[model samples]
Target: MENEKDGELLSYSVTLNSQVVEESKELIKSTGGKLSPILNNLLKKWVEMNKVNSENKE
Candidate 1:
């Protein structure tokens, strides 16, 4: 994000382990920029699985 009014550039750095990242570059090349929805779906599945696990413990 950039602060256009102040002419300042804002950015955030996310640190990730390469081996765990699954090299999405290849997927991007194949899908041609449709990765956002796929990522959202995966995150939804992760949250559901976490909820299921917590429920089982109780």
Candidate 2:
């Protein structure tokens, strides 16, 4: 599948604690937010942070 502007989409299976999943779901629901975007933002931040760290080590 292709995202609106982020290119191709890849699917992966992940496991998380059941309690955490439920709590996150509730929080997202209360805020009218979806999980995909939240996860994407978090992953993007992680990637950017790692890139900066790698550059600093060079």
The number of the candidate with the highest TM-score is 2
RMSD of each: 14.2, 13.8
Query: What is the overall TM-score of model 1 with all chains considered together?
Result: 0.39
**Per-model TM-score versus the true fold:** 0.39, 0.40
Which regions of candidate 2 deviate over 4 angstroms? 1-35
Clashing pairs in 2: none
Tens-place lDDT digits, model 1, residues 1-58: 3466333321111122222233444454566656698785674455556555544534
Clashes of 1: 0
Residue 43 of model 2: what lDDT?
47
Q: Model 1, residue 32: what's the lDDT? A: 65
* Candidate 1 runs further than 4 Å off: 1-35
Per-residue lDDT over 5-38 for candidate 2, one digit per residue giving the tens place of the 0 to 100 score:
3322111111223334455555665656455786
